[model samples]
Target chain A: MTKSKPLPSLIAVIDIGTHKTVGLVGQIIDGKARMLSFSERRTEGVVKGTVVDLEKLHNCVHEAVNDLERVAQRGIEEVYLTIAGPSVAGERVKGFVAVPAHDGKVTARDFNEAMLSAKRLEPPAGRATILYMRQPTMLDGKSVENPVGLQGKRLEVNFWRVTMEEGNVRFRVNMINAMSIHVRDFILASHAAACALISEAEKQGGVLVVDFGAGTTDWILYFKGHILCAGSIPVGGEHLTNDLSVALRISRDTAEDLKVRFGSALHRETDANQTIWKDGDKGVGDQQFNRGTITQVAALRFQETLEFVRKDVLHQLEQIFPGHAVKLDQNFLPSGAILTGGTANLADAAEASTNVLGLPTRVGIPQFEKEAYRKPEYAGVIGMMKAAIEDAPPPVRRPQGTLAWLKDMFRF
Target chain B: MNLFTRLRQFFSPRRDAFMGPADREWRQLIPQDVRRMPGDELGRKRAARSRLPLVLAVIFFATLGGIVWVSIDDTTAVVAGNGALRYKTDGFYPVPDLQRLVGQGKDGAAKDVAAIKADLEMDTQIASADVRRRGDGSLEIILRERKAVAKIASLPGSGPMVVRLVSPEGVQFSGAGYPSEAIRNLPEIIDYRTSGSGDKATIEGIEVAGPFLLAAQSAYPNLYREWSALSLRDCFGAQEDSPGSNLRVAVRRASQPADRPVLTEIVFSTANWRNELAILSRLDLDGLLRRPGITAPAYVLKLSIQNRTSARPVPEPRLVPATTR
Candidate 1:
């Protein structure tokens, strides 16, 4: 008799962005992600990554999930969700514990105590921490990757904690629960994008990742194989479209079409003399607009967004390393910056980022087994899958003793 | 607690403060309202699909439990028979006598099945007992009785002498329900040592003598019929390979004619009794006694002792005059 093959472990992830919501079902086979099904629908009732009308968003999300289940032929019980916006931010905290061993050698227990102490630093009032990224363990004022079996009088540890507004998380949880799917985890959008688009070598050599969505911009900075900071700003490609719509005296739809067709984040010498028609065929009510003006409007807004991200990174760095002076240059970040997300499709986005952030920049497309998923727009969801698999928690072990067993039996 | 306070607490959402490095990332943020609310059509369909396997599992487990319950139920009747206790045996144990042995009352109330089986197996005549309760509130019992290998005559401290049968495993039991001719045909054990009293009595050295007699009766019945009594005076307990241990069987003289010299007794070594019996079966005792020079009225056959003066100890049956033995 032939042996039957075991079924693959499938993971479903959903990215709820301002412009569109995407749902994907995939499984990692032999260290490569095998895409099973992909579905996306236009988002509604959400603005700047905050839900305004939960019912409308639920309808859209419900349809997208249904489409995924129908094509994949598997029911999703829980899903990893990617969260972004102004409310999601990162902060650095430090904790130290005195070595208590008789030999004065730092042990795993000392390391754990230091981490626990660092995590005890509470988040701002209405937010909840989602993840704790460890920096490095310090032994006697010197940084060490692993402190165990090393002689030290004190052990110090630093963590970059990511927190989100508790109310926002609750809303998303309730929405997904309404569809009978539990929210398994909340992944920071920038973190997920970095996991998908950035390589380990780049992270080790210090790199920056910026994801430009429709209504929000999320960015993360990595230096010396550790995350320095991550934050999201509520300004993105839609602001550029609005800027064009208000300056060129055109409809928003025409402005969006022009932005996609002719908009550029960098100005060219020939843009002044060139003109682009809203409708190429010159149909009825079609209008003409200066290409230079469109490029100027988009470039200004894009530059401003990148500058904001640059300032945030510098400020966070200054706070982390108080006495040291840091600069955003090639020497500081050798791997430069990688740009991804839907808005990264704009022409010369990398050039604009390079100009504004003072680092070599390039548009990042996620690598997948399937050619269809290797696109800038799918980076966030794909990264969410990767992060979900890599950072999956260990299985909970049942407690011993009769009372614990009885309690477990009665637990729903 | 007040109703309003309880309601507020019930609707409150779950919040996690800080996630340490050791904390799990996949813990759910459950809200009371979400858990209490019903799901959509697709969720309902999925739930229904999941319930199918659970239902089948329940059905399978229920069937298994029912079978086990029926097998161990003491009140269930034996459907094959019309009584509370159904006795099946190859021996002469009557139902009433067996019930009395197991201490069952006449009212036929249900008793513990394990206790009844243990009581039945305690009897010396029974080798094994299987007692089960059927689905019709009756007990079904099947018994295996031990066969008599030889007879032992014992005189208790306060009773008349009684003749009991010995099994191949050295168990002594009253030869109940056996034909008088069959009992009389069995060779009596003499000069045997025994311990204990009554039903628990065990004969010493019966381990060797009992199996020998059984083997002779089974494989060499024609040679076995001439044996009258067996003496274990030289046989040691559980030491069948000892050189000095031997079993002596007295030959019946009634079958021999008055004018002819007859063989009286056969001696077999305990160590190689089986081989000695096989050799004795092939020998023509009448022809040997009729040799021209033999003049003794009775001769003793010694099949146990070997001639050891040569390089190899060779076993050869030797006949000696009864007076010399």
Candidate 2:
């Protein structure tokens, strides 16, 4: 064999989403994500993040994995997995209790206990399951952001508990494990999207993370460094693309391309003036459309979705910030809203979400010191990697014989 | 090369008929007007152009011997001989400090060279090796590597692994570290004993006792892909498929495990190779030979080879009509 130096470590995420499975491998070199290779395979047997056909899902993962292995020329030992679906649900819970009589101060252990107690609000038997346990703020005595080192009579933890189905989680893990890769950790799609796109200050002050994924639009509200509440609507970018496909009588791919290139949330009367070309074939296939009309069709669906999200969010915001009495309109962005996920790429989506949510909005692009880690799509995986790296303990090396044996014999 | 030659022959005209003594008479068989086919001015011009390159080739070849005698003699070896080999040495495999090793050969110089050569080759069994001075006063050496007991199936391809060997005691050796002209002779490993566990080839099952080789690789020296068949015997009771056995297995095609596909064979390797071979040799392969309509068998045969080591009685042989040997 030719003597060549061993290749560098390249991590690839084969995100088997509802619409597509994206296989992207990157090497984290010098704390920077350098892209080594990428591949995309059509996903099947996956509905709203739940796998319907085990074999079909396996095939999709296999194709992507095979392609990545061919490109990277290395074995994939493990993967950081992300999951999102209709089964997933999120809610905010705050635990409040007095400090111990002796300590006279709230400790980190107190915060952890509060967080765990808050997570206990939702059980695993019935509802899907917890995707992530995100703790943002600790309330000590009052609504203090950081409760550490603070003397207080009572301590409270406000966090979000993201849950999905146990069956779905099992199916996904089994599928991944069957591929001979370990799932180091699991992260909720919303939290991952939020962590990737939203700034620390925004999360500390107040911010909302909206992930318009394939099957659901997940919204996570953060305030005072804690997850206030989370919700998901079945309507998403797929619905808009479907609307365009149906209205224009075009193939799904063409509708998607049109939606990506020309479709916008804000529709104008002048759009009807511009015409789009269609092929000479009948409705069966090969057809063109008025580009403006396609845009209008896409806008109608987008507006309806925005309105739906607006009503749901407004109701929640009214409960939390009753003094403010926020009205979601076209005026400004949500103070805490950051749009992310694959559907977040919709042209002017962040601005549109801002317009509807009535707060300052920014496209949630993952902010990592690394370049490859800066994408919204990788938010979940990078977050999982971050958690693993932070939580990982230093390696302990065992001593060999001889000196070690002498040391053992002469141990004091 | 043969495929290309056949392709050329297919497109070329037939020469058999034209080689006849009365070939012109055969031409007259077509028509009188065909004989005067080149009568037209266009035909005459076409004939002249076709012969131009042919004439230049003959003139060029006439002075070829003279050119060769004047310009090429001692320089020919550097030009057309082993020049490519010399270039390949620098381009591919440059020697790695031969003199440095010679310097390191302090205490038993010849013995040190022999030991170093063995280590370099990854081969343990060196039949004979010698390090001696050459005509140029430089050290010249000859070495023979250990033979390959088995050709392991490497991932993606079955190549480099040909240089590896596994002793009877399961110690793996390779010739990767040595430079030798002749390949060492090794015993042919036609069959292997695969168990639930071990450092052999294992495909799927996680529980193993002896080497389980899913596929032969350098990492697994005990197994190879060249063997036409494999017989797993002498497995431990834990690796057996008997009623009282802890290990139970059902072999079926990877695609359809329940349907009991004949293409996929299941083996319960409980202990040693002897028992595994006994189980295989006892198979009713003759009964199922060339039988059709054999999609998949429920279970072909259950061997108690592994059970022999235990106090348990040998299990009954379960036969399937669907199985064709």
Q: If scored against the real structure, what TM-score would every candidate get?
A: 0.58, 0.49
lDDT of 1 by residue, B37-112 (tens): 3366755665555456688889999999998885666543343335666667776555555766556446776567
Local accuracy of candidate 2 as per-residue lDDT tens digits, A1-412: 9766444445556556777777666665544455566667888887665677888887787667667766765555556566666776665566776677485777888776776665555444444443435555545436776676778777777655565565666666666665555554455656656665666676667777777766667777666665666667777777887888888777788778888877887677887787655544555655556767876777777767767776777777776667896755423233647777667777777677666767766777765555854666556555544433333321123474687656655553
Model 1 chain A worst lDDT run, 10 consecutive residues: A392-401
DockQ list for all candidates: 0.08, 0.01
CA error at residue A149 for candidate 1, angstroms: 1.4
**DockQ of candidate 1, scored on C-alphas against the true complex (2 decimals):** 0.08
The runs of at least 3 residues in candidate 1 whose Cα sits more than 4 Å from the true structure, single-residue gaps closed, are A1-7, A393-412, B1-325
TM-score of chain B of each: 0.69, 0.31
TM-score of chain B of 1: 0.69
* Residue A202, candidate 1: alpha-carbon lDDT: 95
Q: What share of the true interface contacts does candidate 2 keep?
A: 0.00
Docking class of 1: incorrect
